[model samples]
Target: MEEVQTQRESEQETSDESAQSDQDDNQPIVSPPTQPEPSYPSERLKRAAHMLFFKRGRVPGAKAWELKAGIGKSYEKVLDQLDEELKELDLQVKKVEAGGIGEYSPEDDEADKFRYFVRLRGTLTPKEARMSGWRIDNLAALAAALSLVVSKQGKVERKELEIMIAEKAGRWRTLTLTDTFLRTGYLEEDETGMISLGWRTKAEVDLPSLMMLVAEAKPQDDDAEAPATSSMEESVPQPSEEQSTE
Candidate 1:
């Protein structure tokens, strides 16, 4: 009777341990956290616009938003707000100039009215335009340095030119200017610190080429410096040594 009682106690203890182990094994596992979904409509619209800008180089049309919105009634109001924001950035709705005899109306009732388009404009001088277009901030200094070299007939003290540019443009660092010059293929520095346009750089670009690029760029109607296409061709730079070698 005592042996049987001891055996029964051991079996009960084993059963409890086995039950606890099974419960532990049955517990669900937790996964790593994920990014939260966007909570606001405007944020979603902005994300959509950014995506469209990167993919197609412009904003999406009203029709596109409608399709994306999937027949949602808020599309018109959302698109209007988006247009207002885009206008602040100098982008506007692309309008068709003329409609055919049976063409669709320009009102919201017509599907064709929402066709999207964008115009890109630059707000800088010809030399400045290149820098601005490429988003290079040290452009003014590089242009000034290049101008100095060209004006002085292809030779300039690097320090003096940098100082001149700083004086003219106000408080730009030497390293930043130097980096810009190198990146843009505009100038080079020697071990003595004297600066000049590199042979390869000089071979590729000259004052005439700069003038031609300026002339070829689309200018505002009121811009006095805008040159004609014929004048632009005339401004083409003479072939450099690299060009001759080729």
Candidate 2:
């Protein structure tokens, strides 16, 4: 009886050990903790500045999507940084609607509808403004084009535009400069040859301020400025006495 009892005790001990072994085997594996990604590189701001200041393609500046793809999803943060830096240099980073001029809401930034530009932070002196590479006639043509479009409530037929610019800039110069404006995005031309303000104009110009200055301008003897001023003054709408009272 003692031998049988001892053998049973040993068998019970082995069964207990086997159960513990199965429990150990069934335990879930735990991995080491993963770390989060590091902060973006510091050079992203520099990359953003280069992208903004240079015209590398069909347009003057970079699309928001392009900057996001090349830099990061937080590319606007870098742009904000760039804008701050530009303040000292009298320049700024501006984003405008890509296709046409309208009410610009930065709330739409996530949708890739914006293009960024670097432009003067304040108005340039006339001498400094003339230093820009465009010819005097071309600049006059653009001013006239914008004025005519605004006069017509944001659109004008291409022929009407050509004629208006021609009145100031001459016919041969008008055609060439109008094409340049369309190509460079100061004005947009559709398949129907209807003209309207473009992304560049929206980004760089404040039309209401422009109209006000034109309306207030005294005619100058300088031929280039005179034509642009007179044409703009004629086209710019005036506030009626009733609206002014209000």
| Candidate No. with top lDDT | 2
What 10-residue stretch in candidate 2 is worst by lDDT?
A: 98-107
**In candidate 1, what are the lDDT values of residues 165-227, reduced to their tens digit?**
777566557656666675554676666877776432343344665655545767457445456
For model 1, what is the alpha-carbon lDDT of residue 119?
36
What is candidate 2's lDDT per residue for 59-96, written digit by digit as tens? 67788888999898889878887888789999999878
lDDT of 2: 0.82
Q: Which residue pairs clash in candidate 1?
A: none
Leading candidate by TM-score = 2
CA lDDT, every model vs. true structure? 0.56, 0.82
